[model samples]
Target: MTDPETFIRSTTRMLPVPGVPEIAVYTADEATALWEKTEEQLGQTGLPPPFWAFPWAGGQALARYILAHPQIVQGRTVLDLAAGSGLVAIAAAKAGAAAVWANDIDPFARTAIAVNAAANGVAVGLLPGDIVGTAGTWDVVLAGDISYERDMATRLTGWLESLARDGAEVLVGDPGRSYLARDRLELVASYDVPVPRALEDADSKRSSVWRFRAA
Candidate 1:
């Protein structure tokens, strides 16, 4: 039997993002270094800490949406919250947003975002730190695959509500995590994403993209 860590590492590299249909933006060199560092730090750790990781299906879905509906992002300042690999942020930039900011607490993610942004031929402002207390005004806020944990989902929903109340549009892409509050969420679009086993409890599952408005 293969070790879970080895399996995870190998599978992560092969994970594909639907709709993008392009190769992984980062080079093999960068990905190798990232995998080594992440495994060294998190291999034994029971639960992986929230970090700037990449190739998440939810993020890809949101990115696809932005690219397909460029009008939603056109001429707007967009915030990609918990931006791992800056996928959604890159899409926002490609979609002609006036400005794009990618925020994440993980330093590795920050570097990845910068590299990915350059790879995608777009400019993304990288913001480091927790977005909960960070204050900035934007026309749109993008969140992807954020509702994995219960507490995290609650916190994120609250933050999103606050931002929505302030007139910022908040869009979340998830695969129906248990923490998502159906009462307040509106289904925008859903997709049958190909997710890696390491990223999800099941081997693979189809996911959904949900959009919400300030109530």
Candidate 2:
């Protein structure tokens, strides 16, 4: 197996994210080339898309919110669900969270999180594999760009709502993804998140940070 961390570092450049410049990430300049490289080197035909290779609109919005409102995570435990590239997790840790956990089932994503967190000079705990139905040990649960897929969104919404019922502040960063259940959430913040044109319809998206309310 290819050393995912090493491969990521070699294939990508450490670029400062557009809105969140406090941290840097190893990102592919072009998505197609990266995808082809992954296939050629890894020989893995059926792998999850490399969500870690770029800063998504939702994650960027969430990170900006956390930086602007540090008190939300200060001295608290934060879990960034489906933590692609560890952007929001790093932001929470930077904003003074007592502990920040970045969770992603993909091996590449986990490796990317570790590398990105280290690059940002933050200590983010790694949650390997799925933690969808786990205990509500986190003071804040953040999900960014997770509602793009149907099956995962179904599981995610139910689990996040459970955490909300347990009194943990649950926030979801979304860019009007097809699967987001808007009725279950209330908006807390919105941002015009800059994103790659290939990944979004426009140069930026009007993403929002939505709080999950009790049922």
lDDT tens digits, residue span 45-129, model 1: 3334434454677787788778878898999999999887778898899899999999987665677678677767789998888
lDDT of 2 by residue, 1-215 (tens): 56888899888999999978887999889887888888878886766678999999999999999999999999999999999899999999999999999999977889999999998899999988788888879999988999998998999999999999999999999999999989999999998978999878689999999999976
Question: What do the candidate models score in CA lDDT, each in turn?
Answer: 0.73, 0.91
TM-scores for every predicted model: 0.81, 0.97
Best by TM-score: 2
Clashing pairs in 2: none
In candidate 1, position 208 carries an lDDT of 65
Instruction: Please list all clashing residue pairs in model 1, or write none if there are none.
Output: none
Which prediction has the highest lDDT against the true structure? 2
